[model samples]
Target: MMEFKRKALAIAVMVATSTLTACGGSSSSSDPDPVTPENKAPTAVTLTANTVEENAMGVEVGTLAATDADSGDTHTFTTDNASFVIDGTTLSLAADASFDFEKMASVDVDVTVTDNGGLSHTETLTINVTDLLDYYDFVSEFDAEKSSVSYSGQTARHALIAELKNYIGNGGLQSDVDNGELSSKEEIVAKLNSFYDRDENAWDGFAVTFTDAKQKFFSEISSYKSLKDKVAGNDASGQHALWNGESNEAGQYTGENIAFTGWSTWDDAPAHVPADGVIPQKTPHGLVQQFFSQIADNAMENPGGKRYIHGAEQIEANEIPVFVNYDGTDLNQLIQKFLLMAVTYSQATDDYLDENKGLATDNTGRDKGEKDYTKLEHQFDEGFGYFGAARNYLDYSDNEIAGKVKTEEDGRADWNGKHDTDGDGEIDLFSEFNFGASVNAAKRDRGSEVQTDFTKEAMDAFLAGRKLINDAAGTELTTEQMAELLEYRDAAVLTWEKAIAATVVHYINDLRGDLDKLKAGADDYSFTDLAKHFSEMKGFALGLQFNPYSKITDEQFVEINTLFKDAPVTELSEIDEYQSDLVKARDILQAALEFDADNVENW
Candidate 1:
């Protein structure tokens, strides 16, 4: 320890003590008073460590210390810091301040130390934050159960589609006090229109009600997209791209309304559903609603064809009513599939996950009036909502989600993933229920006899993307971060598209079965069954057009439409050629989607 001292002092004294010695002899008893030393500032300030890992706890980086010029002098420290604190000679991060590697890398603080003499010294230090790039995980990053991940609005629309099917086919209106069968065609038409053009107020009230949470479906608030708002890019322009059935700039189908009456096979297939290019001007929702209204009459109306009538009838043994068009199109099946694709899948992959407009929004701040999430984060959440998977989607299996009952040790059965985990008798629609595409993904996967991980892959990508967005809470995404975001979005969107494609193939297999039953001339197998199978196939095939990132190309979709005709050919003699055409369609479908031949054949 080098000797430390205050500045040296100079003094001049006269020998007046000699002259005063005689007089001082008597007063010389008292010695000269001892002089006191001056105080000085401390130096050599430093911290033990200059780096910390992100999300560190306790934050005891190192002790801060300084050397004092005066011996036996002690020191105290303080800082005007945003993320650090000082206790006596010790240092730590402030309780309120946190280090997120993606959001910030270094914390610069000005630290001051004072000696017991009231003198002080100041120095600056930069604590580098280590980037634990893959630190975030599902359970730790998200609010324990759920946080700001609401998609009830989108789910409600899914529920509405189910209720609409019941309303049209199962006499759902007969049971509800606020709703019932219409007295006249005018009332029926008005009520049907409400399904397509309903606002938030009307939907939650009486338009579509969910008595069960398993009816799970879509995400929400201000800037929140309602089901009606997002269906087929629906807007006031009154020209929904999917409804218009117009080709994009590249001459591809825009995935408008697949509702049409047309040829099973033609050499030159047009852009829209009809071979001659006669596209309907109404929304898909509106067209299906018209079908429902026609069912209410129960009359032998042959508006669109001669073989079939627009009335409720049984398909084989089931008493549940099925509505059919003149052209062997099951109106009820078309309603269920078309709306599910048009609203839930369409909005999830096309609008909310869209690269330019949705993901590029600001993520540094929370939603304008909401604190739960940033604008970008909310949009991602909305996209996931449109996907319609429960937050705990990973916990269930394919059989479980498709409502398969479990085999107990005693050979009895019970529902899996349906029990109330929170101990409440009622279900939580967002976390407990599976809706629309989410349910179909599982059902289609399990139904195929092929193992497909559609639900898990899609949900995992959503979780990863959301984690990235949440981790970068205080700044806009960097170029690398943005690239990562797009990658995850692509994975999720592609998986969703593939699940939809698989379902189309699944229906193709069903349609072939329908063809066999008709040819067998079984009294139990009727054109009614053919109508149901064909409509579902057509509706799901049309879903391929909604996503910009669709794996199915425009040309392939055109081929599919060419293969599907205006209606099923119930004429046994003519049916062979249509069946062959369907085989060709199936070939194109499995090949384009990269599906195994066995899966397509079985599904």
Candidate 2:
């Protein structure tokens, strides 16, 4: 009776097993289907591994078991293949499956369990799988690759190029350009890639090539002929030629004091010198005085060999400028000029068409359908208007602005203490107001650079050195009077606030251009291909050129115009709003300079 009762209890327990297990499911009625030992489904299962490292024997066996929810059955385990074992409620490991990790490197064993109802589970166990020698070998190989090998092939070169492009496109090293010798293209690139290949761009160890083939082509042409033809030949006027002569002045002369040889004084000198009793010769005094004394001595301390000279400063007043001339040309300027020219050209062409409408209607004598110049008027506005204000701000940086400061003491001492010089409790009256108005006086009197007491005593020396030019409307003003107004306006623009904002804008533009070029290059040629094909080339054929095409709309032009219309009047913030203002200011400045090129005051 006891044996029969135990069997009945076991059958009841087996029947109740299905209700006890939740199958790791939620309380939702739409619960996932369950796995059963009879017909096993791919149910989610978690695997566990255990070892005996905490024991003195240095060996242990790990057991695995599988149970089914819908069918109550003990999982069967096998060990003939050194995998698993089976019992009743639990699956025990066979003795042969025990691991000895003390003497061996590592041991791996695979275990698989199959329930009587047919559910199965499998797992791999890894034990003590490490070696000090393997770690040392990995370290040696990695160090060798980093230090001794070039980053050739697709994967390595792609990474290197991406890093470099990011550094440049993001303006990562702007200080290097400003305060160091890495200013030029070659210097900048070499400084960036210094660790890998310092002289990577050098051609055959003798010459360096520029990727911009146009510049190289001109350089080669000038190398064989005269530089003047290459430079000034861009226009009919010889103005460009003057620039070439000015820039190449250093190479023209071998001796010193070429600086102090003022053409104004030298042209006035006698046919014979009092000391030499001959036509004034290149004397030792002139050489030392002009070259050594007048210029910065530490100019040529870099590998690039850029030098400073006093004559270079004076070249501005002569036909040949002492320094590189700012021609007021860039993408912004180009866009503005193109727009202005297009407008005027369109107007002119429209007038022509109106007068010749009869001929146009008759279709005779070249009716001039859609003049090309007229089409160019809104080229930038139509095609590139999408860039909007952010692009504009990039052109107008805080660094480009001139900053000036004057002390309160200097202001008070010079003028008669009528104006408040430092916003302090002090009044400075004129001798002459230094761009300051009298604080106590309520009329808002404008400041004067010249004295109100313009006596003959003051006028005699001043008028002697003065020269005059016509105003915007072509009306003449005395040079002294013009200088006063111009200087005042210049001072107003040179505030610390203005300079900082302008510098920021300029850098933003630089960064934007870099990013744009990188993107365009990548789009045209995948980075992998570029590194593989042009990695060794001195200059890449990335084609970083600006060419304006037609097919723009009036709405686009208006958007472009708005970028310049709402420029900053004072300080510009560093955030997005200020950035937008900068773009507008840049566009305006560009338009002002380009549209009114003949007007000197616009700059």
Candidate 3:
């Protein structure tokens, strides 16, 4: 039994050891599989709002970022607003985004971030738009002034002639000469001070020369009347009647009786007298006054006569509507026209080209001393004065007239102000008139160096010509120098012509654009407001005629005249006819100036 028990115990131990070993080996295989966590949505980071200027370029609004709990997840970004764009979790304003402060101050954008697991988070981004800085308020007022200004009949040159006639008759010059007390020219000049009740300083603003031209005119007229008196022999009234053609006999007789019946009649008057009769010497001022007086007389006779005076309306046969101030204080259209005409036609064409060409080359007989300028040089200088160009106009690099403002002292805001803008020494008339056109053209063509070169060349030529005149004082020009002067003159003329043509083209385009806007109903403008635009357009068109180098033919002028004949136009379509004519005129002017009018359309 003991032997058997031992044997069984041993066997039991062996069995127990084997079972324990089996359980340990099975533990490795029986363990459950390891558990994994599920995937989660990304956490989107909060973005701050931003501010940007209007028309800003390449502005970065914010970066859109997201984090995924899942491993190896890629991120992407996008915006709902077309104004914004996104690339790989980065957000930015679009390159060509239009942000107008006037229209809208700010814009909101929705930016979304998404992970590769299909989870997206969207956040609102507010972008504040700021305004651009404005330096000057020039364009608005300039356009307003252009529309507001009024143009009327002859009130400048005609007023001047009428005042002269009235002064000669009412101011006692006629009485003094007819009584023979003021027989000599010197005596008549001495008497003029008493008539005005002031010194020669009072006449400084008058365009006409008081001392020389006035005295010479009176002297010639006095001498002619004396000759007529001698021929009539106490029947002098009949002789006056004959000279005046019996129509103007009813008016009071004075030195103002002279009229431009005919140049031949006045020249042939010595033949009417005996062999011992005195011959009258002709003076330019006298002839000009007589011609003007004839126009005044014709205006008196027919009332609505074709013989209209340049700058005044005919109140009567011998009367014109006069103004209080004659020295450019009256900013009427007639006055402006007269001033332009004085520079371009009277001084430049008549005096400089015709009457004083002799003095241009006469070195031996040059007028020197205190009165240093030659007749031709003075005439040219006078034209420049009328244009209001500074003596050293070339010193200015640009054409912007500084110090311009709305002031009563500036003569009714005719052209901003008569103040000395551009830092020149003196306040001149018409300084910014047509000169602004040239300056604006230069600015507009700044991108084209070749176009700017022409404007610069023009300015240089004008400066050189003015310098020639200024230097020619107390001396005469040599043949070479004279030729150079002429060349400079021609260059100035051509350049200014081109500048004006460019200005006209620019204005035409502007008008067309404005008309298009009106047609499209982009601007809410009334008919009255629309008329102002037409008026401004007509005003610019009228300026074309004032070009010193006029490219418009008579036929073209007639066609252009039809545009303004119906003033204060109400309809947008009303300008269509005018626009067609203007385009034609612009083409002609461009062709004359050798300018390429590309893509110029009526609309």
Each candidate structure's count of clashing pairs: 11, 33, 6
lDDT of 3 at 326: 19
Candidate 3 lDDT (Cα, whole model)?
A: 0.42
TM-score top scorer: 1
Over 4 Å off, model 2: 1-120, 123-202, 205-584, 587-603
Q: How big is the positional error of residue 590 in model 3, measured in Å on the Cα after superposition?
A: 1.4
Per TM-score, what order, best first? 1, 3, 2
lDDT (tens digit, per residue) of candidate 3 on 510-568 = 55555566567674533323333343344344434433345565456545546334233
The segments of candidate 3 whose C-alpha lies over 4 angstroms from its true place after superposition are 1-346, 353-369, 397-399, 402-450, 453-455, 468-479, 522-549, 563-569, 572-575, 598-603
User: What digit string (tens of lDDT, one per residue) describes model 1 on residues 1-603?
Assistant: 223222221111234446566674555367676788888898768888888877675577778989777878888898887678788777888775667665579878788989988899998878898865332223312244545444556656665676677666664443321233455556655655565555545533352244455332322212223445656745322222445455556544455544332223222323445344333335454455456565544322322223223343533343333266656777678767877887777776666788776787888765775556677877788788777776656555677777675565222133353434355665765566677777777877776666778877788788889888888865899999999999999998888887888887777777888888878977667666778888888887866776678877778887887788646777789888998899998888788778877788887
Q: What is candidate 1's TM-score against the reference?
A: 0.64
By lDDT, highest first, what's the ranking?
Answer: 1, 3, 2
Task: State each model's CA lDDT, in order.
Answer: 0.66, 0.26, 0.42
Better of 2 and 3 by lDDT: 3
lDDT of model 2 at position 148 = 13
